[model samples]
Target: MRCSCCQKELINSLTLQELFFSSSQRCYHCEQLFSKIDQAQVCPGCGRPNSTELCQDCCLWQQELGFVMRNFSLFSYNEGFRQWIETYKFMGDYRTRGAFVLELTEALQKYQEYLICPLPLSKERFEQRGFNQVRGCLDLTKRSYELLLKRSELAPQSEKSREERLQMKQPFELNVPIEKIRNQKVLLVDDVYTTGRTLFHGAELLYKSGAETVKSLTFAR
Candidate 1:
């Protein structure tokens, strides 16, 4: 057998867990395999392309945007994955989340010491969208959870340019006190991380809340 992405030959040492998790099918491996510090190919979480370092555009964007840190991921928010995410979270298509959760499980299996938090949608948005994509991912994973904050119903950051996104609004608020998160590691989960404003805001809330370190894993980055 061969890995679809990297074209590496399949090895018998690959357990059923590995095979299943790799398929976007395993709930356990989806929960565990996604939290690693490195990516076997693309990141199992955010799908950031190519290695530990950033691309030139990403570097400049990060510096200009004042984002402190960003992490890698698994699937790019291209057409196939994008449609799948939208359907699963917004359109009541749970199968897509189930499949992605299996993929997530395979990716996160070896990870530890990270508390997971789903990105929150404002109450109105939740009502409009019907479900939080992050919530579905969390429901599938067995990681610890912390609601470090609640996101407000701010203007669409995605519609704005980078400058506009930063200037638009405060983006998030800490419902969970800072005292509760001191010196802890946190792994933030989101359905997507395009432009990264949302994840950055979430990380800021956690950091201000006294988390020792924070990492993120989104379905798309």
Candidate 2:
């Protein structure tokens, strides 16, 4: 299969997080520490440069896609990253959630007073996938992660075409109570941003809930 990162042909790769107990980066299990950066595109995890791509999800059905927002991804969805997602996403590797959150913390700390919210999983998807990948990243941040958006079980997003995903209407709402988020910077977290329909709907929901400025942070671009 094609890599989720560079969209290049993928080759298997090993990660520090997956090594034997002796090779553990261990950092993957701890809150990610920001290594400092001059701007947004450079990844703090690997310190790699020029790492930006619109993934397969973005290439299709981009009409309602908002261009004003910015996103920061932790790593390109290369073979190794794909495996990471698989292990944590499906095999009950919930411990990996902490590492992803640490990664997100270092990336999102720059935006102050932001509300951290996870992209919702349809009831069915949540049951099938077992855990929302967005939760993995949010655990590392000091900010409060509100269950603002919700997922619909009617049709699974994975089964839909990019256009179908884009056409998906607002299915999320604020589950945590907040009087006003107006003008407050809000960060919407998600495991990945393929078509971006999820994030767009999420940003709108935050705004409707009174968020002043809305920003998105993801593990991938």
Candidate number achieving the greatest TM-score relative to the actual structure: 1
Candidate 1 lDDT over residue span 115-178, tens digit each:
6667788888888877776776667666557777787657655677998776556667876766
Q: Which lDDT values do the candidates have, in the order given?
A: 0.62, 0.58
lDDT of 2: 0.58
- Alpha carbon lDDT at 35, candidate 2: 30
Model 2, runs deviating above 4 Å: 1-67, 140-142, 152-168, 176-178
- Candidate 2 backbone collisions, by pair: 5-77, 32-102, 57-194, 74-219, 101-137, 148-173, 150-172, 182-210, 182-212, 183-212
Q: TM-score for model 2? A: 0.62
RMSD of each: 8.0, 10.1
Q: Output the worst ten-in-a-row residue range by lDDT, candidate 1.
A: 29-38
